[model samples]
Target: MNTNYHYMRFLVSPKTADALSLRQAIQNALVQTFGIVGGSIYLDILWVAEDGNEMVLRTTKEDSTKIVAAVTSASTPRISLQKESSFLPALGSTSVTLDEEDL
Candidate 1:
């Protein structure tokens, strides 16, 4: 199958200790929202910012919206799905900062 993956940036609150937990939370949220197969298959965390407050995720275009909704509904860590765009567009912006309220 041919899949087109896009990148999404999220502003995370109360930074997690490591990427593994972050990824797991996201996947768990996805599974809860979208079901086991859909949630576990298409998402991957491409990069986690040094501060751990930001994460760039790559997911199939078809699954993007579901992933965003899943993340937004997760309350414990409070995640905000910042933007959805192609890889280059997501990387093109020079300064991407999370506001205090977003956290």
Candidate 2:
């Protein structure tokens, strides 16, 4: 096994009624922050149920630390990370466990 991996998926719940906008803001932050990284990376933002108030994000990382730092810093009073995970393919990753203790 190469033991190399990259992928992250998380949910964001904003305090406001505009989920889609919140998602866009976060996506912009990620791209702006990580676009300079050398390795090819990908980001996907999904708005929950078209309500424009809840969303999920999937990111393929060249570096998890950078992504985490960017997201954490970009988060605002109206937006917060609900759940997230870092994957390592070299370890044969499977699923992300969102534990009660995570909160």
Candidate 3:
């Protein structure tokens, strides 16, 4: 319900990255995109999947665009944005229909 913030979900490629790797990647991307200022931006990792391939991140609305751009721009250990929303609950909803294999 917080409109001042944005939530994002990213899925890691190869499905083998850990939380630390994801954090480092994001930080590196931010730094690469906007130098040290961007790298210092405040953000929070709300949740990381048990498999360590998916995570939910929280940041200010103004910084959301920068974050999305930074994350997607990174090449190594590819990171893809799965979802983004102003409403935190919206990120919890599944956009894809689950198959038996996923269940």
Candidate 4:
């Protein structure tokens, strides 16, 4: 079965240089905004800049809104929502970047 996903691009403040830091920031945001349960949501990091304020990620269609809320409402490691795509099917794709808009 094909899984539907929402691709999101976020601009992280205080810039992160690595994926681990970025992931932590997002997780913190989730937990802070929605408590421990929110932290359980899986965030798939699709691509990240080697060192910058940008990164692209994916989440299940059902959790897309929750992710947005966490990003917009979180007080720690402040993040700005940049762009998001309508739910797209994740087929046999190898990778995708924020630069490409094919999805």
Top candidate (lDDT): 3
Clashing pairs for predicted structure model 1, backbone only: none
Name the runs in model 4 displaced over 4 angstroms.
Answer: 1-3, 87-103
lDDT tens digits, residues 18-103, model 2?
64565466666666666745323455553343544444545544555565666676746234444445532322334688999997
CA RMSD of all predictions: 6.4, 7.6, 3.7, 6.9
TM-score order of candidates, top first: 3, 1, 4, 2
| Deviation (Å) of 93 in candidate 1 | 0.5
lDDT of 4 by residue, 25-82 (tens): 7788778878897568977887776676777888877887888888788765667877
Q: Which ten residues in a row have the lowest lDDT in candidate 3?
A: 13-22
Compose the digit string of candidate 1's lDDT tens values, residues 1-103.
Answer: 3448788888889876477888888888988888888687677787788888888888778778887889889886777977778663645476769999999
TM-score quality measure for candidate 3: 0.81
For model 3 the local lDDT of residue 78 reads 79
Error of 2 at 93 (Å): 17
Better of 2 and 4 by TM-score: 4
Candidate with more favorable, higher lDDT: 1 or 2: 1
State TM-scores per candidate: 0.78, 0.42, 0.81, 0.72
What would you estimate as the lDDT of candidate 3? Answer: 0.83
lDDT digits (tens) for residues 30-76 of candidate 3: 99999997577878888888877888999988888888889888887
